[model samples]
Target chain A: MENQEEHQAEGVGRPGRPGRPGSNPEAVTARIRARFGDASVRDGNAVGCESVIAERDALLPFMTFLRDDPELTFDYLADVTAVDRLKLDEAVRFAVVYQLYSYKHNRRFSVSIPVPEADPRIQSVVSVWPGANWLEREVYDMYGIVFEGHPDLRRILMPDDFGSYPLRKDYPLHGKGERDNFVF
Target chain B: MGLEDQLQENVMTTKVDAMVGWARKNSLWPMPFGTACCAIELMATLASRFDLARFGAEAIRFSPRQSDLLVVSGRVSIKMMPVLKKIYDQMPEPKWVISMGACASSGGVFNTYTLVQGVDQYIPVDVYIPGCPPRPENVIQALMKIQEKVAQAKAN
Candidate 1:
């Protein structure tokens, strides 16, 4: 346990055998493209990776690929976050995010979406990752994005009676609660 | 854990009494349950400026099993209570908890069903640090108070 400085990423401190290695993300992407012939797979602009894509119809299948692939071993869903894409007049007003972690691979990946502002609806990934329950709720609570198949979706970070998502472009963070003075 | 054992060890039966008296007094591991902005201040307290390491409390375990103090640094929700309790249950006893910031101490500005008024309703709390999101200095003060409480315990 000494010389943690020499330890690999995530530090193999937990017991019961070391985890799996990362699958070729390109291969995974290839599977996504093969599965969904009609949809466009657009790469992500986020850090650590340049090739992460959003295949509109095959997102669930892509998720399944990440989770079920023995080589990929994305067994852990670390976090789910969402952002309002309002400032940019894009196709969707909201973007729901999913962070998938593979202890075996010692690498992580993220899946995201651009939900239409009008409907603000999309299929849920909770079935794919149970941890999505809270993250999805948070997304709903913050960005008003609804997961179509979520078991139970309600306001998470915000009060039940409160209106509007605080994280949205126009939503004033200070005005949501009475902590206006604390912002300083 | 037993009275006889307490007498044999010449220590308080409560894990609280023994640790504060003789061994590992300085190394108080904190379990931070951060949900909002207050978490930032708690981090600041642990960072270089305040250096919580000075108090031998720099090791904050995310897992409750190894943690001695649970620092509820921000907002808590009714839904999150079960997870919090589950984590608390895993922690070894004679443990301490610091309810940091107004949100954790008294639900801050979230006066609604979504946010719990305080962590005490479900879990035991030792110290309450108040501020909308308490400054890092306040967190240091709270740590000092916990240290005081630990130091004043009657030896078994």
Candidate 2:
């Protein structure tokens, strides 16, 4: 018990370890590039945070590597969400974002997968991180993006019978009469 | 020949309807279907600060069968409307509903798709207290109004 408390106290105030490779964004990006080739990873630092865009086909394997690798053990999947870029006139319609954190190194990294409007499907990372279950469901719920191998992918926030994804820019602000059609 | 004049000194004479109404109005048990910010105001009304017991409505019942009045004190979302309707249907007859804020009455400022426009679209409302979250004083006034309605209900 005393040893556990000392370790927790060390975690609370200690700075990033001097020799940890995953403590910086460049090392994370370089590690991904070395494994999956330069074409599979791209710098996506437009949002002022260290982020990388990964190809949809390579997502599951890349995520597994980020978790299982000794130097880059991104063990925590903080959140899974999506951004609909329809109004921005971007070529890709949606980008599914994953916020990953490594408890061992106390570092956070972001990964995004661009999905086209016509085929908005990606491999589920639930096998790599079980906590992505509900988060992936929420992304599917709001953006209408399909996670191919998710165990139970269904609407998490919206009603089960809800027709359209409200977060999409093409959807109206006041809704399309869903609120008025109740039996009671 | 008046019935009260013919009775003994301690005896009383009144119609059954009026007597029942008086009893119901004096001891109203409220079911607080609180879902949002307005619920805080409802709690304030029931707590010692405002003392809702003075009006004889302090007995808060969670079960629909035991309550005489239902106080819907927040925004009802599209997903939550069916559950709210089921609760309303379960309530015993001769019940009253108090729409206790702008949200419950008319969706307040939330004109979005998820939120229900008004709870009255699902259940019959007896009184609507119109404020973002009506003050505890306003809640007390609405309770008094419900009591007045109970007292004035005509016999079948």
Candidate 1: CAPRI quality band? incorrect
Note the chain A TM-score of all models in turn.
0.73, 0.85
Chain B TM-score of candidate number 1: 0.83
lDDT (tens digit, per residue) of candidate 2 on A1-184: 4533443443322225333532344666777788889999899863534589988987888999999875567899999999998888678989999998878757677898999989989999999999999999998888899999999999999999999989988999889898888444
lDDT of 1 by residue, B74-104 (tens): 8876556667788888888768889988888
Backbone clashes, candidate 2:
0
lDDT (tens digit, per residue) of candidate 1 on A22-72: 233444345445655426566576666323547445557777777886545
Given the true complex, what DockQ would model 2 score? 0.73
User: Whose lDDT is greatest here?
Assistant: 2
- Model 2 alpha-carbon miss at residue B147, Å: 0.5
- Give the least accurate 10-residue stretch of model 1 chain B, judged by summed lDDT: B16-25
Fraction of native contacts under 8 Å reproduced by each candidate: 0.04, 0.89
Identify the leading candidate in terms of DockQ. Answer: 2
